[model samples]
Target: MTTTHATGTREEWLVARLKLLAVEKEFTRRGDELVQQRQALPWVRIDKAYRFDTEQGSVSLADLFRGRSQLLVYHFMFGPDYKAGCPSCSSIADGFDGIAVHLANHDVTLTAVSRAPLEKLLAYRQRMGWTFPWASSAGSDFNFDFNISFTEAQQRDGEVEYNYLRGRHAMDATPAPEPVVQFAANCGTDAQTYARDRPGMSAFVLEDGAVYHTYSTYARGVDGIWGMYQWLDRAPKGRNETGVWWKRHDEYARG
Candidate 1:
């Protein structure tokens, strides 16, 4: 009877482990599908010149890559309109300092691009104590093309429809529609939710010294960084059904 009980417990544990593996595999498979979809997204042609001020001085779009054939620009949400650097963007910037060295080993340069003037950007970087390369795109249309910077009309409208999918039907015979809203410039709410409007890190491949825009993402964008919190708390309270208690950095300081 003792041997039989031990065997039963071992089997139960194995079953539980197998269940967890199944869930993990399912999640991985879904993630792979989404990545493949993003890889297939059409690349927009970038023709207009983008001039940005860097620590090294003013440089054109191609110069920002710093001699590397491929450039990855993180369109950070620190604009002149923003009172302070976005909390979510600040979290990502926190990780970037450590990542810079590793990415350099792979022949890629990672830099945070924002619309904030050079002085403001530098001051904020000093305030945060970040050592990563943060550049100002205030003089260029770089942020505008990336969908992060808003114009006067864009801020007034509060949103922009990319494809005009106003009326559509889902698999069922019911009117279904999804509106991609851009409200960051209009309202300061949902800083995390601006993924629907903001363009993600864009990669440019150089062929014979010519730069070409390769890839960009917006939806489920900052998952790599933001999703890390889910693992720390088994019972995440909000968002994705997880009960993890997460608060902005500023919120925790009040106590």
Candidate 2:
């Protein structure tokens, strides 16, 4: 598709650009306000002794901070039954590993958690060339507690809360969307198993030798962390699209 716009004089273009700049500045101010509010939110103390299987061996939730004051957990959607992580989550993660080092240097640790067992997570992480820490919550209630992984019975019942809301799911339909089916196939699983897991991110802070859940965001709330989308939002076309047009970075190489 082609888009045509009216040609404008240099003065006219400058005037239009100045108008847009004002709006952009206001938006940045509001974004800063939201960040302050998020930081002011109360931190809930975490008491459950959740365990994770990491390359460094079994570790607890507090251990994830790795001597840092803060921890950021990306709930990567790789369920126990899937052969790989979700493609969409993989796309988000493509922009994360590079920033993890910067965060680590700033007294924060960033890592990904999934239910796909340590072995599978390691294999896929190797394929993706991701250097950041990733761990498996397999055989633990971590993902279930965080509402990122669901059970078979829950799938049949078709009511699982995500992002703090409960709604009818694709599992309730006779046929789910083609993309859901395709994503399942790509992960070597069916739609039901694939949909059983959702993507999320959580923040934690260590204080007084105790771990506290500072905040969490799921679904669209996680979008701001996607560096590519942040760039696309500034592009001329601005995320112009009619359908899914991305794949795992490694998948592009194979193609």
Name the best candidate (by TM-score): 2
Quote model 1's TM-score.
0.70
TM of each candidate vs. truth? 0.70, 0.94
- Model 2, 140-181: lDDT tens per residue? 998888888888787677678778877656543548788888
Best by lDDT: 2
Model 2 worst lDDT window (10 residues): 165-174
Clashing pairs in 1: 235-243, 236-242, 236-243, 236-244, 237-242, 237-243, 237-244
lDDT of each: 0.63, 0.88
Tens digit per residue, CA lDDT, model 1, 105-197: 888888888887888889878878888888898867777666555554553344532222222112111121222122342224333333222
- Candidate 2 Cα misplacement greater than 4 A, ranges: 1-3, 170-174, 253-255
How many clashes would you count in candidate 2? Answer: 0
